[model samples]
Target: MKKLYSLFIALAGILCFTSCGDDYAYTAPEALDVTKADLYFKAPGGTGSIEVKTDRELQATSSVDWCSVSVSGGVVTAKVVKNESIESRAGTITLNDGVLTSLVAVYQEGFAFGIDASNLKTLNANAADSTSVIVTSSSPYIVNIPSYAASWLSYTADEDGKVTFHFTKNESGAPRGANVTISCDDREKSFTIRQYDINSFVGAWKVSYADGEDLYEEDITITSPSTGALYLNFAPLTPTVTPIFHCTYVNGGLKMANGNAQGRYSSYYLFTLFSSTDGYISWAATYTYSASPYIAEDGTFYMVFANDGSWPNKETNGVALGAFTSATATNAGFVGTLATYTDLVLYK
Candidate 1:
């Protein structure tokens, strides 16, 4: 009976020792190593994921689901998920089982005008990105004066912020300078009076003829009607010899000259002033004459002569007769050379 009692005591002591050991024994959870942490997108909109790592094995049961995450008022709350492999993901994601959370900023594409031409006749705007913005005009707008494609009228913001626009008269017979309003992204701006004047119409012009085989060396001067009367002299060197006249504003058309002159009478003279946006003029003229004659109506003697002839043939002949003998005349034709002129001076 004593031995039995001793055995029970030993068993009880061993049980107490085992219970103490069990109370003291414990394994700490592994700490997650978040080597890299950042919000993928700095600008607004889109999801951001957090990455984390650990040296020891992680339990799936302790991991949190990512779909349950939520972000509000610019604050992001994510559920931690155990992903062993380092990789990118979408939506709100937490790293290392709730150790770290990253929130992506939400943003909408924005546009701005680096230069504002609202007060002027033209409007210019710069884009922040490759984004495109719809542009509308409040008052009637005319694009591409002189031409559409060659004119700088509209612009798309390519990655770089460079853009240009040109504005002018919209309706036919519109005022020289008219006001216009430009709008973009619900923003509106106004431009003052605009003009499509000869200043913008005039360009480097060359005169060519014979199907462009021959080109004349000359320049053209465009004088505004407001300044004074306008005239185009064919040969400025000899203004009187060959001059072309035109009205300052002749029914919006250029006045032209046409006439006939006698030969020798080198009607070589062709002075016609015409209008041309293409920078060209066509001038022409004609000449004619009658032949000398020898005739008699009352059977009186008469003679025909060419060149200069002298009657009463004396070295210093002076004669007086009761009647006359003959008389004559002739005809001829003449042509002139083409010439050109301009307002711009060119170096030889």
Candidate 2:
């Protein structure tokens, strides 16, 4: 019985050894392969295909929303839309056969589309007879005109991406603005046109001033004389007198003139009585600027005032002085009592 048992053990050991040898000699299955691993499409994209050389069932997917992929039998197909941008794009198709994976590179040509409207983003035109603005693009684009603005403006586009806009005379007394849209494929750009009347600055304005130490605000009336200069009653500057300042259009801004330049006020107050407080009379008040002041298109006004020996003056703020304290100090007028008034901005 022992010998029989020994023979049984030997048979079992031989079976184990044979199984181990077979394990060493075995080979894994082949990975997924493709006949064509790369596919290219034109700008007007269409379907592309790659032949799979694997016996296993294959699954395919795309990496980009613009590209899609499918697997049928041993073939992988990719479909893509037209590339409408100036840049070229690429994507990949992933193929998986359970045990191994492969990637099929997909390339598509991009259609050029761009608008060079940076230089012509904003255009200002007078109420003259006619005016035109031109823009260039890489591809032809569609011009979207507002329904209200169609009567005054017209456009023409060429195949080479040259767009021209023609505007007729603006009979409207008020300033008018319009925005035109330029679109190519899914991309869009816009530009604005503003037409101004000759007397656009004739109206009421809200004025604000930053005079270094205090902020003075008031509402003023602006009036223009037929064709030349504009005048506004600025009460905040000259409290007891009829405050009026004049400005002229120059270099797209309203250039201001000093009170003396208008021949209505003196260069120096020269002991003028402006206030009386607690039996004390304040005298010799003057507004002076170191630099020429101007009003910008966006209602921004800038001025630089000279330092009045007592207070520091800035671009937006200026210094003023009370020449005398009372009748006893009349000889000490314009000594050192300086108050500053600076940035005087006006907006409608």
Candidate 3:
């Protein structure tokens, strides 16, 4: 029995050693070359493959296995099992069974101009990485700011990365400066304003006889007599006035002089004046005229003077001559010819 036990023990030991040898754990193949290992995709439930080459032939019992593959945060990763084959195979073989990972980066495009409250345009953004758009103005506008206040305006950005701004005008109702601001990405850009002139106030004008019997009967174009000089010629049949006839602009109001005879002479003279607000002018004058009087459509002045010595003796009613039909002043002064009439000489 002891000898039989000994033999059994030996057999068991030998069998254990043989099984251990045959069941050796697989190790990743060394010196294996990755010739064409890259990302590849297949249909669902289909096997994906990664090709690799080896320096030697792999045993038939060995096999290659892919452990895992993944892509995240713009990066790709792959875990592969080295050669499972006992005998190495040369050239390239396909690797399958693990996920393949790859990475892609995110891109953005944006722009902005102007202010937060009265923004001209809001910020803009796009995913295409590049884009462009046009802006248009809706009105001819005037922005006013007090001289005492800070002239700079404010602006802000929109969600899409666009910005807008507004400008203030000066006391003269003109834009202060040409500078406009564009705010974007915590930065600013400036543009200039287009300026315009107030040249509409300078031009030419005329006067004609209106009222009973004289309605449109006498048409006169007071021609330019000299620099800042005007001439009025009466029709051959029209009545004449005294020798003194003066022409001047009062407070920007165009006026003509009317002279007095004998007891009728008063400190104030009637003036034929032109209105500044509207084109309508009338006859009015205080004995002592105001300086630089701002003329209005309702304001008046007259052409006061005696008609003749014979008519002067009688208690004659003063007449209100017609308003100024036209009056023109220029930087170079008045232009044209003076008219000639008896009894009335031109007054400065």
Candidate 4:
């Protein structure tokens, strides 16, 4: 019995010596290291994360309801909500390891921009009729006006936190258009503006034959009896017969229909004697088709008259006149002169 008890005592002593090898237990230092101290998010909020380089477990929390934080595998991620207001916002993300604490600043941008033109996309051409456009944004924005429109369009900010755009009167006869852009942060919006002056074309215009050996230059008068009816005096083109053309507005220009009874025309021989005064026999005759005429964007006018069968160069006995004297004018040389009358352009 004594030998058994001595062996058991020796084993117990060995176990105690093995468990108490050192006076104090070994413990690692408490530490908390975060990779990032700040985070940023766009207006359309999203997720952002930072790396925690510590050996201890940590808890992450956000100070604001708009920003939420979570920790997984030593990575702290923050989720931000979409900011609808125009004002920017900031929050703090706190990380704790029981003994140490770290902080991360979270910033989010706002998304709000608008342009109020009072539902008007076009403006009148009168210089006295100036207009304004209102702008609304949540953040600072930049206005970009095209180089061609910068001279006529301007903007100003009022003390009441309102942005207003001013437009100068457009004196150009034809319609003018431009696109204005507003930029805030990474987003941009464009608005198109148009100005037109319909009555600007009603005035005396210089006229000349597109194709004729005779040097003919005169002033043609254009009169508008109503909003849609325009009358152009043809006395400059034909001295003998003063045909007046009844035109209507078509696509920002004037157009005359074929065989329009409103337009009265007469041949040089039918109206006046060849040896009467001018000594030149004008072969101006009626036509069948008149091309659509339009005013170009550059304020130039263009008109074209084509022939398709309906030529009135026949004699009293229904015989073709063929060709005449120095005043010889063929079906192609009588009215509108050339196939395309671009040389007879009128300018504003």
Candidate 1's residue-wise lDDT over 1-348, tens digit each?
011000001112222235645643344343444443333321122343333354333222212243334433223343433222223234423322354322222111223322333333221122111112233322222222122222223333333332344342333221122223344334455442222322321223222122123334544333344442443322353433443333232222222222222112122433322212244222222211111212232221111111112112211111000111111121122122233322211111
Candidate 3: list runs displaced more than 4 Å.
1-206, 223-229, 238-245, 250-253, 260-348
Per residue, candidate 2 scores C-alpha lDDT tens digits across 1-348 of: 011000001112222235645633334444466666546766667888877777778898988999988889888878888887657688777788887776666777677555665445243555444433444443346788776677787777655556767677766554455667777666777666656543765776677766545788778877887466777665543444455555565433454443222111233342222221122223322422232334334423332223222212322133223433333335543454333334556654
Ranking of candidates on lDDT, top first: 2, 4, 1, 3
RMSD of each: 28.1, 16.5, 28.0, 18.5
Reference-based lDDT, each prediction: 0.27, 0.54, 0.27, 0.53
Where in model 4 is the C-alpha error above 4 Å?
Answer: 1-98, 102-110, 119-121, 159-161, 168-178, 185-188, 192-197, 204-222, 226-348
Of candidate 2, the 10-residue stretch with the lowest lDDT total is: 1-10
The sequence of per-residue lDDT tens digits that candidate 4 reaches over residues 122-160 is: 444546344455666655678776776667777677654
- Ranking of all candidate structures by their TM-score, best first: 2, 4, 1, 3
Cα deviation of 92, candidate 1, in Å: 4.8
Residues 1-348, model 3: lDDT tens digits: 011000001112222234745753433333323333332211111222333333233211112233343433222233433332223222222222233211211111112233333333221111111112222211112232223223433334344444333333323322122234443333444443222112111122222333323334333334445444333443432233322223443322233443212111122222232222122222223221111112122222122322322222232222333212233222132222122221121111
lDDT of 3: 0.27
Clashes of 1: 10
Model 4: pairs clashing at backbone N, Cα or C within 3 Å? 86-138
